[model samples]
Target: MEGSCKMKRRLLMFTLVICSFFIAGVVSADEDILLQQLIEETPTGGILELEDKTYTGNIAISKPITIIGKEGTSIEGGGTGNVIEIRSDGVTLDTLAISGSGMSRSSQEEHSGVRVMANDAILTNLTITNSFHGIFLNKSKNTRMSNITVVGHGANQLGTQGNGIHIMRSSENYIDNSYLEKTRDGIYVEYSHNNFIDNNTMTDTRYGLHYMYSNYNSFKENNFIKNVGGAAIMHSDHIHLEDNKFSFNQGSRSFGLLIQTSRDIHVLNNEFHLNQRGLYLEQSTSNRIEGNDFFQNEIGIELWTSSTSHVFIKNHFNKNKVHALTVGGESNNDWFENGVGNYWNMPLLDLNQDGIGDDPLEYSSSLSELVEENELAYLFLASPAITIYEKANDLLTQHKVMAFDKYPIMSERKPINVASVGVGIILAGVGVYVYRRRALR
Candidate 1:
């Protein structure tokens, strides 16, 4: 009986060992299959898996493949050649860091970190740093870029010869949810069309957003803060700007938005604050401005001769140093809301108790022209000359500056408690009178 029991135990142990070996073989086979697929498909599909190691080579991708990375993967180009050039269509790049490219300095020919000459490609979640041009796309179409970070250190302030993201002669591209900092131009689109730039943050760049000879594009919900050269849109048309913020962009020739030789554009609901000039329109016409906020700027809007036939409606202009509108030539056919006026922070005397001032707000031509020439005219804002001008306007209009629409829609359009302004004014007046009387005594 003991021998029979020993035999059964040995048989059970042998069967268990056989089952374990079979399971191990299956797992190993699955791993080998995956690795084999990766290696086999790499040459045709051009998949170069990235790790923390440095790879120095000129790789041209001719087929569609995804080059993925384990976290902390870096591709170092060694500053002698182009890195990861795409010449094929339908490529995807994600979660990789590429650096050390950019050999050519000619504006026409330059090497970038990732150069795409293909169509229908997507680049996402890439960190491209310390390169001449971060991402350069030339003569490509139907490209999409999102969640990309392009950083150019400027290499001792010589400034990048190329742009962070350069799209030249490319069409139907979309860039969204990206952050571009410390580059020559954050994003430069030249001779492209049907592009969309939305929800991006750009800083410390020459021009945050530049569209030269590009048409029919849209910029929405982007924050361009502290950009040095500001934004320039020249020789473009059919552009639309909505819900963007341009703030603290101050310099001699800097402006929040510059439109030159552009037509049929619409700028609405944008906030421009503390900029040298909130908006500079030169030789651009047929634009509509509505529901925008311009505050604490050197000049709210500077219109050179090319700005004509523009409609300014329901825009809030407050605390700006110069005239709200500077009409240059007599042929400039611009329109403003007659009764619905902008806020200048100047007192309006409602003598008839009608809630609307009885006179037209006569903006001074000399002052406007002077401000157009010199931005420092803002320093003399509180001088007696301004007071005299206000009085003269009052006399010309019978103590009525401008009439509000009985109920004008206040833009930036907050609900105002009338009692608050009234009580504060009364208290301020009482305090001033008391102080003056005490000083006399």
Candidate 2:
């Protein structure tokens, strides 16, 4: 019996020793340390904690680590330096406020707040302000950025150069829910392909979103407001723009949306207001434009030379000062909604009272075309020469005068409010009962 008890005691001691070793291993494995030491001691897939403090020096991350910043943490680069440089793949930066990065403009790509040259990296919920080239991604594929806000104050204290978010030679990336303001260009995608930019807000920038040689990219649900040159696309193909709002982009040469030297693009369900030109299509062909709203613009839609075979359907052109449709070149093959045209907001007398105008709406005429080219020609709109020009066009080319449904529905189709209707019916029944009772009394 004593020998059995001794054996049991030995087994318990061995188990306790093994457990102590396991506990020691776990405690060592889950140790949290400083940023530099954590980077050094951490394995490939470890977490690096950046505490809520101002980090001044530049830090180069060479390994695949997740740099998690504490909430309300600010990482301020003094000047002419990058706060976080990601050189390895699988890097993620979240909830960091990076600011004060601007340097001398030696090269076109000189200063940046965060320079990421790694693949499969993500930057989210980061605010970078007063910096040149905030969040520059070069040759990085499959990089995703969301909820990033970049503000370039263009303060006199620092040299002003570069863009807010510049993606060069990067492909298969996504940028969404971002806000950019007061930068050279809010989001510039150059030489990239197959990217997606959606749900972003860009204002007070030179150009809200500029895409050059970037093909097959989709932009949707973005708001470009008060930009100098809003949303220019050049030398790209198969681009799709949908449900974007371009408003208050007022400049002499600026446009709400510009498509140049592109082909096979589709623009649909967009709204443009108070811009110099609502939609400008130049040096492009075989594009589809449908269900767009152009209101209160100087020139609603302009198709300059080299634009051809574009389709326009179900578009609303209302309250435009000059021309609803300004067509140049010999481009035909454009389609309207069921042979019905856009709303011109002009007086077309219903002489026959058949719910259609007796005379067709003149979308393109000599006077309207001249007013589109020269903004000063709008002064002569009330002159007798304008009427003479319209009359001549109506007599010669009656095809220019297109007719749309006079009282077209302007509201979107929404679901019925059943609860409200039920309540209204109940209230009406109660009122009728009270009225009958009062009458009987």
Candidate 3:
């Protein structure tokens, strides 16, 4: 009886294992059938709508087709190549979650969530994560990438990780309304030109917008926060960076904007706040920096000796620990362009009330001359002792002027505080009620 019972138990265990394998094979068959339907069935230039289900493998769209996924539709990669690769022109991928790209940077093709080698590709409402590159436009032109959220593989080292949006040798692309974080660089433009990047939020990256040898690019209304460097416009020219917020990019060698070895750049109407350096210019010339507001920065502007022929006008420098720092030479740059100078938050001598100061506003101090030579001076920027020492030295010695505004602005052209006005109105109403009560009594 004991031998018979042991034999029955072995047969039962064998049957359970066979049942589990059969179920797994059925599921695998279903996944393979769906993948075959996607690859071998879709016609060229057709609109294929995926259901709200998960599909797997590396899809290569080699024809002009449009793939629109339903809500909650996801395409997981096979962990070998790019999740999706568009090879033909006029392809579109919308509303899909693409992830699990291969980690092989040594491959000829970059491993990415989506790789577009075709022109006029449109990618919208994509959630790309856990990929080497979120979206890589490789020599693709006239592409429109909008409303996408790209998160990188944050666990990888900086040298091995890729950028959120990497535009390489591409032109005339429109990238808008994207959120990029934890990437090596938020949006990297390398040898790309005539690109319009607007309404994007980039944070927790090396640089928000890393421009390298790119020209005729415009970045407008973007928010670059909590990054190592906000935007590094290096070895490039003809860039228009306007209406962006560069804030809280605090660290050593960090700045809201770094225009290095570039030319013909126009930086206008941007807000640079709470940065280690609001703007850092090095070896750049023939740039127009105008109508910008720099507030609460460690140093508002750090103009290197090699940076020349820059015109700074209508900029407001407010509450910075150091207004401007010139290293190694006199400031040959123009502080006032076309009769309007920057406002340094100082008392201006507006004798004729022409809204300009009569005397030139000088940024100078004997102690500043000494402290500017030391890199450790940044640590004591908020120290009262440093401020007192600078003022005392200025009063006792003939201070050397670092930079001067010939026509310092006198009128305040700041934004109106609606919250402050509301508080004042409430206070006045309470006071009037108290007075009426006293009179009645």
Candidate 4:
């Protein structure tokens, strides 16, 4: 009986050893096929259709070639360096899953899933994960990055992780249909110009979209949600921000949009809601803000003393904690343009049949500044004493006017457009019918 048991134990140990060797062999075989080798062997302008396999190595494409891969094609770095590096223009990489890049604090270290030093390149349908930076472009122009998804490891420590898409000194690039989460800055642009960032969702980052010294860019239909800071545009100009949604960016110093030291920015048709400060402008000038909705924010617009020539037209401010406030003295910015002004939730009496209110809207209050200066004075809010005091100060003191909308529009309770309502109902009915038909089929 003892000899039989010993023989059985020996057989089990031998079988386990053979299985380990087999698994190791399979793994080695996969690692042996380096993507760099294949790229180097292929001629310039060649098209390489990668097989459905996991290539474990760093790759560098120095020539102009196109590398395409299907589903399940992965390029996993060994946690040592970038997964792919493109040095020549006209290089295209599509439909590849990349991960496991080296982490570094230095920007010169080049620790990214994909680093593009080339111009006029196209990167589409690529998914990057666990990388220090998903895509880092340095001085690369006319690059198009579309339908890219970047999932980070959620590292909040500074310099440990990088932006989902970092554009540095690049121009005329387009980033569209991308989703970025848990990165430092979802899309960071520095010294870049003439870029179009549209149809992207950036959430849970330090800043959803951060721009520093970037100009002539248009951001349309992008969603910035639940970020520490929603969108920070600093020292830039000629920016067109249209149809973007900035919401739920709540923090001590969080803002829906922070425009600092920038000029000639057009913020049109954007939604800024549920933020600590809807729009915090510091030394920003000559910007045209029109057709925006500022709702449920702590401060609708916090204008610094240096902000000037800002034209606010046809905006809707509803239920904001404070309609508008200034840091120091009152701002000298224009609130009305082209015979149109914002709709402030205030008491207005338009005796005439015209849509414009007869009286100008006082969008700021000296009483609010008093409450800020003296905290105990907040108790006087809604008290007749405060109102009397403000009136007395306005008459006797030379207090600077905060903001005046001479041509303020009527309240949102105005009659709805019948044409718009009928069109909306018809569109809703058609959408429901199509959805039901698709479900049935």
Name the candidate that leads on TM-score: 3
Q: Which is better, 3 or 4, measured by lDDT?
A: 3
CA-lDDT, candidates in order: 0.74, 0.76, 0.85, 0.84
RMSD of 1: 11.7
Per-residue lDDT of candidate 4, residues 218-275 (tens digit): 9999999988888999999999999999999886567889999999999999999988
Each candidate structure's TM-score, on Cα atoms with residue i matched to residue i, is 0.74, 0.76, 0.83, 0.79
lDDT of model 1 at residue 34?
A: 33
> Which candidate's lDDT is highest?
3
lDDT of 3 by residue, 1-441 (tens): 999999999999999999975543221222435653564455666667777788886888887877888789899997879898889999988999999898778998778999999999999999998888999999989999999999875524667778999999999999999999989999999999999999999998999999999999999999999898999999999999899999999876678999999999999999999998899999999999998999998788888879999999889989887778787667689998666688889986776656778898988754445555777776666578777877787788766676788878875673234466779999999999999999999
Better of 2 and 4 by TM-score: 4
Global Cα lDDT for candidate 2: 0.76
Which of the two, 1 or 3, has more TM-score? 3
lDDT of 2 by residue, 37-95 (tens): 55666566666566677665466788787767777777777686766688999988888
Instruction: Name every residue pair that clashes in candidate 2.
Output: none
Worst 10 residues of 2 by lDDT: 407-416
